[model samples]
Target: MWNSQSIVQQQQRLAHVLAIVQDLKALSMLPLLTNLDLIQEIQTISTATRPFIPSPTNGLSLSTELF
Candidate 1:
């Protein structure tokens, strides 16, 4: 007996699980992750995993200006 609300709830739960899995995947790379390499890997992962957003919207961007 699946309703639309139930389907939405399940989708939300799946999204939550996916977020956890991504974090675990990153953590699992730690032992072999060097400081510089790890930073690069994390930046790549973060950019790829994040959802797309339009300009003039509330979202983060991959800033090119290095501090």
Candidate 2:
């Protein structure tokens, strides 16, 4: 349900992030990409992203019907 303008803005942000990741892989961090310290960084990012996820308790009702 995002408006077109909002979606475009988000897409631009993702593009910039992707560029940064590409730069990391191609320019400097390529050698360290697989270092053990990366695991801790990934865990930290996951922890930060966890709270924004929506839970099933919002307002949806469940149904047992299979057909």
Candidate 3:
């Protein structure tokens, strides 16, 4: 049974981890040998943090078109 305060703290930590992962991705700083490991970590963290985030109120999908 998790309390609200603990949930908020966990969400914050997950958000921080996600930020670091995004920075690493943007800088291309990871070694080839660890790229797969990093990708797995990113997916794990994203899944963990998804519940704390709210969906868009406007009913628009988060995905965007490149074309």
TM-score of each: 0.52, 0.39, 0.41
Which regions in candidate 3 have their CA more than 4 angstroms from the true location?
A: 29-67
Looking at model 3, report the run of 10 residues with the lowest lDDT sum: 58-67
The lDDT for every candidate, in the order shown, is 0.73, 0.63, 0.65
Q: How does candidate 1 score on lDDT?
A: 0.73
Off by over 4 Å in 1: 39-67
User: Highest lDDT: which candidate?
Assistant: 1
- Please give the RMSD to the true structure for each candidate, in Å: 10.1, 14.1, 13.8
Q: Across residues 1-67, which tens digit of lDDT does each residue of candidate 2 receive? A: 8899999999999999999999877668646667556655555565564422323887322333334
- Model 1, poorest ten-residue lDDT window? 58-67
Give the per-residue Cα lDDT of candidate 1 at 26.
77
TM-score of 3: 0.41
Candidates 1 and 3, the one with greater lDDT: 1
**Candidate 3 residue-wise lDDT, 1-67, digit = tens:** 9999999999999999999999989668656538668756665666564422324785322333233
TM-score of 2: 0.39
For model 2, name the residue pairs that clash: none
